[model samples]
Target: MSAKIEVIKNKILSENWFVLRNFTYDLTTKDGTTLRHRREVYDRGNGATILLYNREKNSIILTRQFRIATWVNGNENGMLIEACAGLLDNDSPEECIRKEAIEETGYAVGKVEKLYEMYMSPGGVTELIHFFAAEYDEGLRANAGGGVEDEDIDVIEIPFPQAWAMIKTGQIRDGKTVMLMQHALIEGWLSLT
Candidate 1:
């Protein structure tokens, strides 16, 4: 038998960039009881991220930008080093990651390998993040990518060893970025030498 839930109320709290809603529901339990619960959910839609690596140079492409949420949460300067990522926005996960890579890192990537999909913050946010990795070369750079007008992004290229070290030193704190880096290491796509 499947569990059943009925929504008692749904109120929109905000609808500026994305959406924030408060939901009240009654969930049927296995013990023949119904429990009522309330939760606030932030809906920003799903997103995709890519870690660009260059086997020839033994390096990876990353981006640094200011995140307002982190800043308000006591992250000193709020600058975050992360993999290139963006919302799906009517596009497939693979398509979104390709566009994000070019727009954020100036790399026109190809042949991306999909890693996994995860719910970033399931408790309060409704965002499913798709992770990917691709090989890149200098010849594939089409333009000087720094994101759109409102987005101030700085592209950085670092050796694989240095990037891995950053995670241990608390320099790279973004969860998605860390996961992709570790995936690369475990897959033997990176070398210590």
Candidate 2:
């Protein structure tokens, strides 16, 4: 089937960590029938969520920390297991990956391989987080990266094989983290063997 172009109307409902707004699309049939749709979205900045992986030593650097909001409804183990990620923060996905890598894990990435853009939760949020993986040595330790005083994070390094097992057994709960590691396995991106 084919689609046609149409004009739209958008109204802001509220703005916060993410933006929630109402939009109306006006579609006119070739025969002159009019149709409209009102939909709402949560504005999670078109930011990037990156995964900084070290292929050389076959390890993936991740951040583990307690999430307060998540605890209210999330698992009793409110500790979030996630990749090295953050908002785009005005930088390109490439730049965001590099910066977040150092800031969250203290690793200086040599290069980044683009994975894909992801909307963590499109049904409610607008986070178009991009995924990436870089090669580094887990044995090499730089500054211990974490967020500012307001932000809390603890960096953890996991062997590629262990990460793969987690995915295979459904132990990796984080969506983005699971996706990246699974891709690495399927694509042979982490086959040190």
Task: Specify the highest-TM-score model's number.
Answer: 1
Candidate 2's residue-wise lDDT over 1-193, tens digit each? 3445464877889875567888787776777778786778777676655566655667777788787766787668787777877788689988987887888888877767888887778776767888887767744457888876777888888887887676667456678888877777787767645
What TM-score would every model get versus the actual structure? Answer: 0.95, 0.79
TM-score of candidate 2 relative to the true fold? 0.79
Against the unseen true structure, what C-alpha lDDT does each candidate score? 0.93, 0.75
Q: Which ten residues in a row have the lowest lDDT in candidate 1?
A: 184-193
RMSD of each: 1.3, 3.3
